[model samples]
Target: MGTFTHGATEWDVACPRRPSRVAGLTMAGFRVRDLDPLRMVPHPAVTLLLEFGAGSTVLDCAAGRQERGSIVAGPGLGTGGAVRARGVNVECVQVRLSPVIARAVLGASPADLDGAAVPLGDLWGREASRLREQLGDVPSWQDRFALTEALLARRCAAGPPVDPEVAWAWHRIAVSRGLARVDGLAAEVGWSRKRLWSRFRSQLGLPPKSAVKLVRFDHAAHRLVAGEAAARVAADTGYADQSHLHRDVMAFTGATPVALAAEPFLAVDDLAWPGHGTPGRPHVPAGQRPVRGPESAQPPH
Candidate 1:
């Protein structure tokens, strides 16, 4: 675990020692004290939070929904800047799932969540309670992570998987950091444009274009969090210019780039998800041919 202090708050965050066997899944453990209201910034992945401590945590969504206990939020949560999290002496495991694997691991498409933060009990039933107890009884963070990985691996194996083409398209978007063309993706996957759009939206929750923008913004936002100038980040991240970057940032976070740069959610990424900014290949099952995209083509800077 890595300990860091920001302002007057202290955080103990830990990442898994080894990468997860399930692709598109990452887990982190967080122990926080003297907590403040945290702005939940929009990101490209589905988020699952499993609370184990006795402290209380509340998620207030812009859509007028409030939830406690374990929570699952779909992609693009807090896009309207209304999602705020407040808690104290909180201890939990946070999991990030790529949209490609969310269906199988979560037992529902991201579309079902509809950009809302829902209690895990709603999705997992009594199993949610069982998981809470199991995780809380665990002795260490590594054990907790191992348990989570085993459960997710079992769920993914049993549930239905997204179409191979859909998985491939998502991987392409992620690897390109959201710069891949939809038409090109369709051609590469041997699916008509209409088919690809419908399938991708139905299975993964968001449409192809939206996925691209979200992934791209995620990349650019993290760069800003790292103290890079907006102008340089925009140039390197395929934005038309600084103004274009500003518009996208405003649309996604409802905050200016300057304001977002100081957000703690992004700040914690360094400790919770080291080497996470770069997109990696999605885990395709055995006997499946890996989909190829124009990964070698550099985006315009």
Candidate 2:
């Protein structure tokens, strides 16, 4: 069992395999406040979302798709690209998996996993309902950790091999780095930018650059709602400027930065980690960043 806590939220994680809890399946226990509507952008990682709320109308992010209503998956959900959820309340456990872990569990390519919300039993057999119910009784973070281990034990008994290196790199740069260029990252990983792009797309379902944008804006939205200055966040997260940040935020969230920042009903406690729940905006030191010309503020590779 591994644990990391921040204020009202805690990621109580566990795995069946030794030395690397992150290698196999893991679950994060989340408790957060309600939030204003925000967009779910694409990422380098595939996610299995299980909402314990009443219901949500998720906007299908692919081309030529429309928003559709989704239900609580007894076992949970599997899909890709950005999604949207409106009018959510406290309490939910979001289960996310690295591409390597997803491949090990599903025995299919990440691209094959893309689609609207599917039944958890469609993939997890009949134990889906039991698993969803287990979330309610979990008291300590350790219990959450143990639950994840037991669940993964059942799934991984027949799972495939997972590349620890690839999973680590994906979580580190694409998941943790937020929005940033991957050119330098490619060089550091000993893979050409083209090769990295191909692998990232195949394993995670989206390019690293796109994933970074999603997470960056996700973080930005939280901060903007928390009353952080748009200019400060834009510069800190590698956006070209305030306007550049505004456009991306609007594109991803369908709301202006100012409007998002001024939202009265939004709260950080309602968001799931690596998804939402970032406290007040991240404060980036002025001298610690690179300066860009007006022309450079636009989005680019």
Most lDDT-accurate candidate? 1
Query: lDDT values of the candidates?
Result: 0.85, 0.49
**Worst lDDT window (10 residues) for model 1?**
292-301
Candidate 1 TM-score over all chains jointly: 0.93
Query: TM-scores of all models?
Result: 0.93, 0.59
The prediction achieving the highest TM-score against the true structure is: 1
Clashing pairs in 2: 32-269, 32-270, 33-269, 33-270, 40-82, 240-297
Per-residue lDDT for 1-301 in model 2, tens only? Answer: 4443434334433332332244424355443344334445333244555444343434344454444322222111212323455443434454545555565555455545553445555566546556656755667545655775667655644665433323434544544447444666554445567866777667655566766666566567667767788898898777889999988866754567876664322342343233335312222212222212223331122
State the local distance difference test value for candidate 1.
Answer: 0.85
Model 1, range 17-53, lDDT digits (tens) per residue? 9999887899899999766988899888889999986
